[model samples]
Target chain A: RKLESGDAAEARDNFAGFKLIKVLNENTRNKCIFVHGSFEGSDDDAVVLMEKTPFDKQSISAMLTSTTDLKQVMQNDIYGVYTSSPPPDLNGINTTIIYPATDRHIMKYSAQQIYLINETAEEYQEITLPFIESQPFSLQWVYNILDKKAESDRIIFEDEDTDTGFILLPDMKWDEKLTENLYIIGICHKRGIRSLRDLGREHLPLLNNIAKKGKEAICTKYGVKENQLRVYLHYQPSYYHLHVHFTHVNFDAPGMNIGKAHLLLDVMENIEMQSDYYPKKTFTFTAKEKDPLYLKYKAAGKM
Target chain B: RKLESGDAAEARDNFAGFKLIKVLNENTRNKCIFVHGSFEGSDDDAVVLMEKTPFDKQSISAMLTSTTDLKQVMQNDIYGVYTSSPPPDLNGINTTIIYPATDRHIMKYSAQQIYLINETAEEYQEITLPFIESQPFSLQWVYNILDKKAESDRIIFEDEDTDTGFILLPDMKWDEKLTENLYIIGICHKRGIRSLRDLGREHLPLLNNIAKKGKEAICTKYGVKENQLRVYLHYQPSYYHLHVHFTHVNFDAPGMNIGKAHLLLDVMENIEMQSDYYPKKTFTFTAKEKDPLYLKYKAAGKM
Candidate 1:
C-alpha cells in the first residue's frame, strides 16, 4: 500500500532537515531510521507524525540490498516509507490521514509581531524612535541621542528590560521577602495618559505616603531613624509608567562608607528603562565588586 | 643788627600781603607750632615766622569758611603762600606747622609723575626723566615707583596680595626641616629664571619630580607604595615664580578628579606667556588633600 499526503510531505521535509542525524547514527550505529505515519482507527483526518526507529532501519537496509533504481533516495536523504497497518483485532488496515497545519510557524510569527510591538511601544514612550531610526545604531548615535535628550529633560531614572511586575509600592518596603537589597518602582499609567501630572493633588501625597512608609520600613529593618536613611529616586521614561524608585544604602556597615553607598545608589538610580510595555521588563544595576560600602553594609547587617 | 634786604618797602608790602597768619591761626587748634632759630639768632626772623603762621591762617580761614570761598579755591583763584620757616617735626606733637614747600601737594605731584613714568615704561622699558622743578622725597612713593617699574616689566607676581617672599630652593634632600610636603623643583635650569616658556619647561619637570618625591614621602610615611599616593598641585599665579607644590590628593581626588585634574593641568601647561618685557618672576603651588587610593596605600604601607 502507498500513502501520500501534505502532512506526510511536511513531516518528511522536517525529518530530512533534522541535523541530529550524525549524532543519532553515531550513537545508534545506523540502527535507527525515519518513518512517517498517520493515526490508525481514527477518523480519516488524522495528522501525520514523524518517528525514528530500528525496525525502519532494518527494512531500509533490506530494501537497499535488494533495490537498484531507489539507490539515490537511500543515499543522501534516505528515510523509511511505511504504510498504515491495522491493529491486531481489525479485519483490514484502517488508516486515518490528517493534514498538519503550520502551527509552529504561526506561533513564531506571532512572537515576532509581539516583539516588534513591544519595541515600537518602548520607542514611542521614550520619544526616540524618529531620532533613533534616523541614525545607525552606533556608539556615536547612541551618545547623540542621549545628549539631545539630556539637554531638554532631566532624566531622573531609567531601567532597560527590567521585570517591573515586582516593582510595587508595597513591595518596595523593607521586608524579609525581598531577597535583594534593591527594589525598582515604576511610575506608569494607561497608554496615552499623562500619569505623572494627573497623579492629582492626592497623587503627590499618596506618593509621599508610600515613600514615607517605605522609609519607615527600611528604618525599622535597619534599626535606624528615617533621617539616617538616604533615598535615591531614579526617573526612567522607558517604563512610561509614572513611578519613583527609592533605594537605600547603609555606609556604617563593615566595608561600606558614604562614598561607596553613593556610588551604588547612583548605579541603581541610573538604570535605564528600555521596554515599551508595562509588564515585560529588563534592567540591570552594576557596581564594582569590592565596593567598600557594600562590604561595610553587609557587615553592618544592612544589606 | 638789621639784615640787609632788597627793597625794604617792597618787603613790607610782601609781608602785608602774606596769608600765613590767617592760615596758622585758623589751624592752630588742630596743628602744632614749630620755631627754628636762624644762624644769626635774629629775633626779627623769629618774629617773621610767628607772624606769618597766624597771618596765613586768618587769611585762608576767612576765605574758606564759606561755600563761596571753597568754590573759589576749587577754581584755583587764590595765590599760594610761601613761608621761610622749616617744616615742623610732627612725631611727638599733637599739632605741627607745615611748610608750603613740604606740603602734600609736592607728594601728589610726584605720585602723578611716577604714574606717567610707569605707563610709559610699560610700553618702552627704558624711561628717562627730564629735569623737573620738584622731586619726590617720600620713601613710600619710592616703593610705589619700584612696584610700578616691576609691573611695567611684567616681572612681579602680584595677582593676589599674598605675603611676598622668595621661594628659596637650597641644595638639600626633602626632609622635615622643609615644609613637610612643600618643595620646588626647577625643570629647565637648576636655577630659576624670569620667563614663562623657560620656567614652564624647567619648572614642569621640577614640579613632576616634586610630585613624585611628595608621593614617595607620603608613601614612606604612611607605609604605602608611591604609585598609590595621590598628590595635588594648586598653581597660584600671584606668585610668578615657578615651583612644584606637593600635597596628598591623587589626580583623581574629589575636586581634583580626572576631569578637573586634566583641566587644571592643561591650564597650567598652556598658560599664555605675557609679553617678553613682562617676564613672570613668581609662581606658586598649593597642596590640596590626598586621594582615597593614596590614603589606602598609606594605610597599607606600600608607597
Candidate 2:
C-alpha cells in the first residue's frame, strides 16, 4: 500500500478517515467492545477490529501532534481505519471523534468508540449514534440481569414482559448509614436498552409502574410511602448500562448533583418528547483523577 | 508629608505594619463592619478602626504593593492603621489567605482570632467565650419574622419564648419533591446566638432541645421519626444568626455537603468539648458570583 501526497494532506487538515465505533454499553467487570462501526455510507456497515491494531506511542504522538497518513494502511482496515468510499457530503461528515487525527489517537485497541451519557441531558453529542438496531442487544450484562430478574434474592418485582425489574443489592454497608437511619438502595433495570436514550413514548408505563405500584410495595413492606423513596440515575454511570438508584429520601447518596441525577419521572417525561433526546444533548460533570473515563479524556488532551 | 528614600526599601519587602482587624461575620446585605483587629502584638487586646480612617485606593495599593512607613500618618490613627505599642512575638504572623482568592475564604479577622481548629483531628480547642451579653437579641430580621411566625397564615409553629420558631417558605416549588413530597424548609432560630462560633458548653441544652423535642414535634406532625429527619448548621453560616435547617432525609438540599453541613449532634458534641470550636477552625466552601463575602476578598486583591 502506498500513501499519496493528497492522502497526507487529507490526514493533516481534512482528516478524511473512518474509525470502528465501539459501543461500551455494559456496566460489569467485563468490558464488551463492539468494535465494528456503522457509518451510513461506509463500504461495510461494520468492520471488526484487527486483533493487532497499531497503537504504539509514536503513532499516538503523531496522531495528537502531527499529521497521519493512515489511508495507506487503512485500505484493508489494517490500523482500525477503514478506507471507505467518500461519503456524498464529506464536509458535513462528523467523522472527527472529539478531535483531529482520530485514527492516529487510538492509544489502545479498546480505546476507540463513542460513549453515550444520559444524566441531566447528554455529555457528548458530536459523534453519531451507531445503527443500534444492527445489534439487537444494545447493552451487555442485560442477558444475565434479565435471567436473575425473577429470583427472590435479587428481584423485588417485575412487569408483564419483564423488560423492567427491581433488584436488591447484596452489600449491607452501613458506615455512611447510621443504625437508626435505615437505607435501601436497589437497581432498576430495563432489559435490552443501553441507557436512558432507549426510553421513549413506549416506556411511559414503566416509569408510572415504578411511581405507583413500586412505591406502594416499598411503603407496605418498609412502612414508607413512594414519596420517601428517591429514584434516579447517575450520568456517565460507573458502567455504561442504565439502571435507576432507589434509596431513602433521607440518605444523602453520591451522584445526586443536579447535573448527574436524572429523576425517573423527569426521565419519563423527557422520553415523552423524544426517547433519544438524551444522546443528542451536552452535559457537565466532575470527573475525578481515578475515574477510567477521566483517563481517556486526559490521554486525548481534552482534560 | 514628604516621601522618604528608605520607604522604597521597606515597601519592596517588609510588610511589618499594624492593621485594625475588621470582623466580616454577617452574611446579610448590610455588612456590619466590626472594625477592629487583634494580633499577638497589636496594642491593647485590639484597636478599633476610627471612622475617618483613610482607605483610599492609592494608600491601599501602596500598603499592599509597596512599603508602608505609617509613621508619617502616625500623628493620628489614619488609614485604619492604629499606632499601638507592639506586643510579644511580632514576627509570628499567619496573615496569608488562600490563592485565586475564593470568596468563601475567610481572612484573619476577629473571626480568625477565635479560630481554634486542629486541621488534622478536626477538633476545636477552647477560647474564652465572647460575652454575647452585649445584645440580648440575635438576627436582624427577628422582629418581623416573629410577627409572621405565630399567624397560621405564615407561621408553621412557635415555641414558648417565641424565639425558636418555624415559618413556611412561600414557594411550593419542588423539582425533586413531587406532589406528596411536601417540603417545609424553615428557619429554626435560637435567641442571642450570633453564629456557631458563639456556641459554648452553656448552649448545649439548646442543641439537645433541637435533637429531642424538635425532632419529636416534627415527627409527630410529619409522621417521621428522629432518624428520618436531618438537622444541621452551616459553618460560615448563610447569615450571622444561628439557624438550623430541618429537611426530610430524602431531600437533596443545598449546603448538604459534609464540609458545609455540621450535623446537629456533631455540633452539640463539639460544643460540649469547646463552645468556641467553630471560630477556631478553617473551612472550605464554594463561592458563587454576587456573594458580598466574595467581593471583600476581591477588593483585597485575593481573587
Candidate 3:
C-alpha cells in the first residue's frame, strides 16, 4: 500500500476533509487505515477526520465514514479491517488543514521510545549507586535504619550519651524491629588496632583464610548460582576505617533491575545477624532523658 | 666546540674531513674537546664512529683520539668485537667493536632503556590475572587437586571394575604433587530436599551475617584494628555452584605481599575453620579405606 502525496494534498484542500482511507491485501489478507486531522487557521474551526478501510485486490478504497458504514461493507465477508484512523470532528468545516495529523502514530512510537530510554536510565542509576558508594573499592556498608533516622534529627549529644541513646537498645526491642525478610550486615572499624600496613604484612594468610571460608558458607547458604554475586572492599578515609561489602547486584549483569537492590539489602541484613563481626548493643532514646539537654537550647531560643 | 665540516687542508694536502666536537660549559667551564672520528666515510659510518664516544662530559675526554689514528682505533675497538669482516687475520686488528665496552655511563643507560621496555610487559601478566579473576561474571571451574593427579589411574581402574570402583571412592583427594599453593572451596550441588539452588539463595544472607559478626570477632580476637580487615567474593562457575568468598587482600593498601592464587587458597582454608554456616562432616581418606575390588588394579599400578 502506498501513502501518496496526492491523497494528502486532497485532504488539505477540503474541510472535514479526507475522512478515512483503507488498504487491504487480497492474497494474505492484511489491512490498514489512515485518518487525518488538523487545526490550521482558527483553533475552533480545526477538525479531525478518520477512515476505516480494508485492502482487497491489492488496492484500498476511499474512507469509510463511520463504524456502521465499515460494518455494512463487511457483510460481503472479505478480509478483516487492517487499520483505522480516528474520526474527524463534524462540527468544524472552515479551518485550513495545516497538516494531515500523524500525531497518533508519532505519539505511540514516541511513548515506546521514551519507555526504553527511561528503563535504561533507571538501570544505570541502580548499578551506579553501589559502585559509587563503594568507590575506589566496592565494599558494602550497613547502617541501621533506625539509627540513621535518629541521627537525622541533628541532636548534638556527648559520645557516651549518644551511644546510650542509639547503640544501647534493649535486645528484645531490637529483634522486634527486624522484619522476617530483612537482614543486617555490619561494617565496623574497631578502635586501637595498628594500620593496614602492619596487619596485611603479618597476618594476611590468616585473614585471607577467614574471608574465603566466610564467602563459601554464604554462597552455599544462599542458593546463588555461580558468577551471580560480587563483593567489593572500600576504605572510608573519613572514619579512618576500611570495610568490605558483598553484593549480589552485579552491574555487569545483562539488565539492571531495581529488585536487586532490595535483594542486596536483604543480604546485608542477614550478614549482620549471623556474624559477630560488629558490636551490637542496646540503646534508649527517651525524650525525658534528652529534654534537659534540649532545655539549654530552648533557653537560647534555638530549639 | 662546533662541528667544523666545511673543508679542511691538513698538512698542505686538500683532504675532505670534519671535526666532531662539543663544548662543555659557556662561562665557568669553557672547555672544547675535539671529537676524533673518521669523516672520509659515509654519514652512516660517521654516525657509528661518533656514537662510540660517550656523550657525558665526565667521560668524553677519555674517549677522544686523533682523527689520523681512526683506522687503528677502529681496528682496536670495532673490529672482530661484534662482526667478522676481511677474514680474521687481517693485520691482526679487530674491525668490529662492542658499542658500550667498558663504558659504565653507556652501559648504565642501555640497561635502563632495556628495563623500561620489559618492565611493563612483565607487569601485565602479573597484574591482569587478579583483575580478570575478580570480574563478577568470570567462570572458574574447581577441581579437587587430588582428583586431577589420579585421573589417569582412576580411568584405568574404571575400565576394570566400572561400577564398584567408581562408587567406592567417588570423591578425589587433593593433589599434593602440584606445588602451587591452592585450595578447594567445596561446593556440592545437592538435589531433592536441599538442592544447590536453594542452598545458594539461602547462603548469601547467612554468609553476609556471618561476615558481619566474624569481622567483629576477628578484630576482638586478634586485637587488630577494624580497618585492617576486609572481605571479597569470587564466584567459581565450573562447579556450577554459587559461593561468596571473603578475602582480606587489599591490593592498594600498604604492605600486601601474598600472591593472588595463594591468597584464594588461604581463604578456602580459613572458611573451613571459621565459618558456622556450613554443615560440617568428617570423612576419611586413608589408603586402607580403598575399595577391596580395586586392590587388583592397585597392585597392577592402575589405581
Candidate 4:
C-alpha cells in the first residue's frame, strides 16, 4: 500500500510475502533462481511482484554450490511488475524446474533479436506472434544469465549515484581492441527493472558519470583519448536487462547500429525535457521470428 | 621480388628508405596515423606497398606521452602492393592520398551479409555482392589491428601443433554473460592474411590447436563444460581480419545466423578436404547504404 504509491525502498525491504524459487540444470551446473510474489492490481486480476536487485552471477554461483552462503544476497530490493504478463510454460525441457505453491506470480519480457528476423510482417500475424503468445515466460533462465566476472571482477569501476551502486564491465570485444580505447558495459544494481522506460531521474548521476569520469578512466587506463569513447543504451537490447554500452569510435561493434544505439547523454537530456520521454514515444527495435516476444507483439498488432 | 616469392619474414627484417607519417587532431586529441608508402608495379604504372604490422594503440600512446617508452616504435619500413589493382579514386577525401606511386602490386575482394538483405536473388546481387566487391584490401590496417594482449596476455592457453601465436579476445557483448564461460575473440598473428579464405594447410596447427587446446583452457578457466564453447568465424566480417569468435553454446549472438557464422573446426575440416574451399564458394554478408565499400560494389555492377 504505502510502498506502491511512492516508497521504493520500503517496498524492497518488505520481501516477506514472496516465495523464492530455484531453477537447476546439471548440464549447465548452473542454478537460476527467481522471485515469486504477486499483488492485486486495479485493472489486472493478479500481477507478480518483481525484485529490483540486479543479478550477480557470482552470488548465484556461490548460492548454488554452497548451502551456507549468506542469506542477504541482493544489494537492494525494489522491483514491481510494470506491464501485461506472460503465462508460465508447463512443457519446459528441463524437468528440474520448481514452481511456487501459488501459481499466480512472476513474469518475463519475451525477448527477441531483430537481426534474425527472417519472416515477413504477415508471418508475424500468422506464425511468430502465436508462438510468443503460447510460449512460457522463462524468468528463471534470464536470472541465471550473469556469471562470476559480472559480480567479482569484470568490473572496471563503479560509482555511487542516486543511492545505488552502479557497475562497469568492459565488454570482451572492447578489451581486444588493437589500441587502448573504450568499450565498457555499465550495469545498475537494481533488479527486475527491464528496460530504459524503467529508469527515472534518480539514475541521471550514474549515466552522466560514465559519460564523463568513466570515459576519463578509459584514457588513463587504456590510454585512449577521452573523445574516442561513446556511451549509449540499446532500446530493444540483446536482453531485457538495463545496461549501457560504451565503445571506441573506431570499432564497429554489433549493437552500435545507428537505429539501435542511443547515446546516454542524449537519453538524460531527453528525460529532462520530458519526464516520461521513453514511455511517451515508440521506438523501433529488431525482433526475430523465433523470439517469443515477437509473437506477443505481433498478436497485439504492434509489430 | 624477394618480398613476394618465398621470403615474407626476411622482407619484414629488411627496412630501408621509407618515410613514416603520423595523423593527429588537437580538438578531439585523437590521433589516427596510418603508414603510407608506395612504388612502381609490374603491369600497372605504379603499385603501392602496405606494411603487415597492425597498429598498437598502447605503444603509440606510450610513444606520444613519454621519451623513454620501452616499446619499439615502427618506422621506416618498406612495403609494396602485392596483387591485381583497384583503380585508386583520384577523388579521395584526403588529397594527400597517393595512388600506388610505388605500385609494385595491389588487389581486392567482395563480401556481404544476409540480415539486411531481403530479396533472394536481389540480395545475392545488391547487398551481398557489392559488399564482397568493394571491400578495401586494407592489409596494412588489418595487420595493425592485433595488439600484444591478443598475441600474448589474452591467450587463454596454448597448444603444440600451432607454431604461430593465437590470441583470444573476449567479445564486447560477452562480458555481460552471467556465467564465466568462453566468449572469446580468437586472433592469429599472421599479418596480411585477411580471412579464413587466406588460410592454408600450413596454418593447420594454429587452427586445430585453438579448437582443441583453447576449448580446454576455456573450460578450465571459466568452469564451462567442453561442449559449451563454440568456435566460429564471421563471413564478410565487420572488418577484414582473421579472427574467430568463441562463445557459450547457449548464447544467441547477432552473427550466430545460420547463413553467416562458420564454425572454426568445420572450416578447418572443409579446408583439409579441399584447398580452396572458401575461395571456390560464394557466401553472403550484410552491408548498409552508408558503407563506402557498398558504393564501390554498386558502381562495379556486382551490387
DockQ of each: 0.00, 0.01, 0.01, 0.01
lDDT values, one for every candidate: 0.24, 0.38, 0.23, 0.42
Identify the candidate with maximal lDDT.
4
- Fnat, one value per model: 0.00, 0.00, 0.00, 0.00
Find the candidate with the highest TM-score and give its number. 4
Which is the winner by lDDT between candidate 2 and candidate 4? 4
Q: What ranges in model 3 sit over 4 Å off?
A: A1-231, A234-267, A271-303, B1-177, B183-197, B200-303
- TM-score for candidate 4, please give it: 0.34
Q: In angstroms, give how far residue B159 of model 4 lies from its true place.
A: 6.0
Model 4 reproduced share of reference interface contacts = 0.00
What TM-score, computed on C-alpha atoms, does each candidate reach?
A: 0.18, 0.31, 0.17, 0.34
State which candidate, 2 or 3, has the greater DockQ. Answer: 2
- Candidate 4, B109-144: lDDT as tens digits: 111221122123344355544565565444442343
lDDT of 1: 0.24
Error (Å) of candidate 2 at residue B40 is 28
- Model 2, position B62, has a per-residue lDDT of 22
How good is model 1 by TM-score? 0.18
